[model samples]
Target: MVRIAYDPTPYHFNHGVLELPDIVARLGYEYMQLTPHPEFGPFHRMPKADDELVAALKKRAADAGVKIVALQPVQRISWPEEPQREAAVRNFKRVIEITAQLGVDTINTEFSGRPERSEDSEAGFYRSMEELIPVAEKEGVRINIDPHPDDFVEDGLEAWRVIRGLNSKQVGFVYVGSHSFHMGNQAATLLPQVGDRLGAVFAADTYDHHRSNGLRYITNPPGNSVRVHQHQEIGNGDVDWNELFDTLGKIGYLDREDAVIVSNVFGENEDAEGSALRQLDKIRELISGAAR
Candidate 1:
């Protein structure tokens, strides 16, 4: 009962494209995670997009029968300078508002960053959440902070700090298995701690040796010497996805509302797309087999 989704970034898809909804639908994903155009810094802080454009996008998604699950931010905002940080928070607030209007309930961002070793890194997380949580509560959308590889709070333990620091139901975490695999944490043990507070999980392939080495590629895939975190299609990486899915199931995530496990496919070539879709199909079949 685990639902699957695609990040749609590397595939040259975004909100601006009028064809995105149809593309997502045709890809057979149940949820679409929207990202801000790179030029706009991922959150698209232009206040409101053209109403006509919004209407058209909404209509297309409706026609395609896909749900827009969460609004994702551009990566830069995660570890911005102090001066730029406030504006990033403001922009994130606006993104949540936009999602709320669209009837979506989650705002996903790279805001869970680790600042340069300072007194504020720990306090800053709480301070930032205090400002945003009220806005999220008001807008009726939850905030999901993604734990990126190099960012502050990149691993599950650090992510737990922010999640526990905020102590607000409105704030949650997005656990990317690649992130966990990169950190070499036991996914089964870490997942239950986050549980439903896990707004979403990015299920992609990661090479254990590569992820362990901070994503550096000393060797290439199939080369027998590569150890970098190459974002491979699912079923091709070192992670035991069946065990990962079982862990998710044990946490009562099966068929839960907004339970989205998306694949953040790195390469955008046609081969990558085929590989991604194939991975999803395999995952769907695996989950079904597990249920039976």
Candidate 2:
């Protein structure tokens, strides 16, 4: 029963936001998850969508027989700087409003905070959450956080601890397959722990930088710290698709009505449609295999 949503980021540049529904339907997906789009909103910026725009998008999706299952807006709501954090909060409020208007109850986003200033950024994150949780609660929208690379918390278990500290069911976790290694490559361990709080799963492949004794990628300075990953087509990289899906099945994530699986392949833009189709096919295969 897990809902599968297609991310239209690959088509955003060539097609406008208004045209995304048709594009997604053409790709044979019944559900669409709106990622950061310039016309609607971009990363770290306030939303540009108004009431009229929201209405138009809703009608368009309905006409195309596609449902907008979720919205993803990447704002720096956890910025260490006070002014930036304030603006991000304002932007996030609008994001929640849009989600409500679209009849979508899920907002998948990141803890967009500074990694270097971890303490201050963590404080800013909690402050912003304190202010926004009420709004999300009122709107009946759940916020799922991704502990992205360079964020205040990137490890999967630690990020779960941070989200758990909030003590609100309105907040949850996003497990992006591409970030598996950065998140400790412990899907078996993390997914079971996240359990019912795991809001969404993003399907994309990424190489294991820890492979080959860390010589897979090399930088000029030996000691330089950097996180390298990719949103490649499923099975094109190191993620163990069978193991990941099996874990979800074990945790009962694959059987939840609210469970969302998103196809977010971005590495093969030149053949976006092909990648989308393959992701959909693979996701369905995985789900079928995961059925207990």
Taking the tens digit of each residue's C-alpha lDDT, what string does model 2 give over 1-292? 8989999998888889999999999999999999999999888889999999999999999999999999999999889999999999999999999999999999999999988999999999999999999999999999999999888899999999999999999999999999999999999898899999999999999999999999999997896878899999888999998999999998999999999999999889999988999889999999999835
Range of the 10 consecutive residues with the lowest summed lDDT in candidate 1: 38-47
In model 1, the Cα lDDT at residue 287 comes to 64
Q: Report the error of model 2 at residue 264, Å.
A: 0.2
Best by TM-score: 2
Models 1 onward score TM values of 0.84, 0.98
> Candidate 1 local accuracy as lDDT?
0.66
lDDT of each: 0.66, 0.94
